[model samples]
Target: MAVHGRTEAQPIDLTQVRAYGDTLNDGAIALSFSLPVPYGDEAKEAARQLVRQMGLHDPQVYHAHDLGEGYTWLLVYAKSPYSVDFTKISVPKVSNHKLSHAAIEDYWHEHGGGEKLRVIGACTGDDAHTVGIDAILNYKGWRGDKGLESYKCFAVKNLGAQVENDRLLAEAAAFGADVILVSQVVTQKDCHRTNLAALVDLAEAEGARGERIFLCGGPRLSHPIALELGFDAGFGPGTVPSDVASYLVQAVVQRRRENAQPI
Candidate 1:
């Protein structure tokens, strides 16, 4: 197609995208579910009816197995007749440019010329998981990225797991921490959310909210959810040490510039 004496660029049709199986836009999907019924022919028919009620077509009970205790596991193949406008979807994400371990060190050297960034990390509340905090704060980092402790620009203290939020804040005050890193792994009954929000609220009440950056990480945490919960940033699963390091450096540098201080 030509527009205004120029050929128009071809754009993908994203408004009606569907799951692909053997071909594009086939809408073919495989679903697995368990039912409290015996593994038999009746279970297969029941699975098909359930798929039909879900608005899918041509439900095929390809596999049905006995899970014992009157339970049946079923795999169904079906075609969905629905689609979503991919172009209109929007999601909040961390906007900082990812930096390598070496680059982060170099950037801190160039921009952060004063005292090292003080970081205090802990697995607050009843959550006793330390793997996430250890990955970002320990010398032996997760997956091969050197942790913040390895960086000359940061002084990190990993307080292990299940530390009370009040203790975390008090320790941060004593350490004069510039950033607070929180890790919560056990989120049963939304306890992680409650614990995280309580920390932020306490910080605000103690007048430490403005002087420090608050970060959180876990399997359930996301950048958007963290912002909503009053955190400076959030890191989810698969986050490496360098990811948090880069963001800290950039954020501190920007904050210094905004305060009319040397970076």
Candidate 2:
């Protein structure tokens, strides 16, 4: 395409774009799920019919397997003719997401200039998942960035998984933690929301909410929800340890500066 002697490819219509398989806008989609019915011809038909009922066209049961105990797993292929304005969609995210690790350390050294700040983290409640918390607090770190345990500016303690809220609060208080990090992965019946709220309540009861920065991170967490739960910040999936380290350091430095007396 050309406009005024300048060449440029035509832009895709944001409102009309569809999922592509063999070609653009083919609306090809593949879904995998398990059905409680036994694996058989009737089960496959049920899957196809269910897909059709959900507004997808030409549902094909490509594969089926017996998952034991009257359960059947299936891979379904279908075409969805739905489209949305991609440009009109928005997702909430951290606004100060670009700070580097070194920058954070420098700010702490210049502003607080105190000994290593204590940080305590764990998966609180009945949730036993530790992958999210470990990735951010373990020395091995997630991917390449060193976790908080490896940071020179932080004295980190990860209480492992399935920590009770009272225990977490007691330990954080004993350590005089500057940051209280929490991770919740098991969200059945919105339990994560409840567990996170309980932690906030505990902090408030102990009058620690003002002294410590409360951070909650997990696969289902977001900044808005975390704020709603009375947390200083919230992190979601795919967030690296350095990203967290930077944010907390920035927040602590800012807090300290605001508390400093005038010359």
Which candidate number maximizes lDDT?
Answer: 1
What candidate 1 gets wrong by more than 4 Å, as runs, is 1-12, 36-50, 256-263
Residue 190 lDDT (model 1): 96
Tens-place lDDT per residue, model 2, 170-230, is 9998998989999999999999999999988987998777878899999999998998999
The total of clashing pairs for model 2 equals 0
TM-score of each: 0.81, 0.81
What lDDT is obtained when candidate 1 is compared to the true structure? 0.89
TM-score of candidate 2 to 2 decimals: 0.81
Residue by residue across 96-181, what tens digits does model 1's lDDT show? 89988788878888888767888999999988889899999998888988888999889988899999989999999999898999
List RMSD in Å for every model shown. Answer: 5.6, 4.6
lDDT of each: 0.89, 0.86
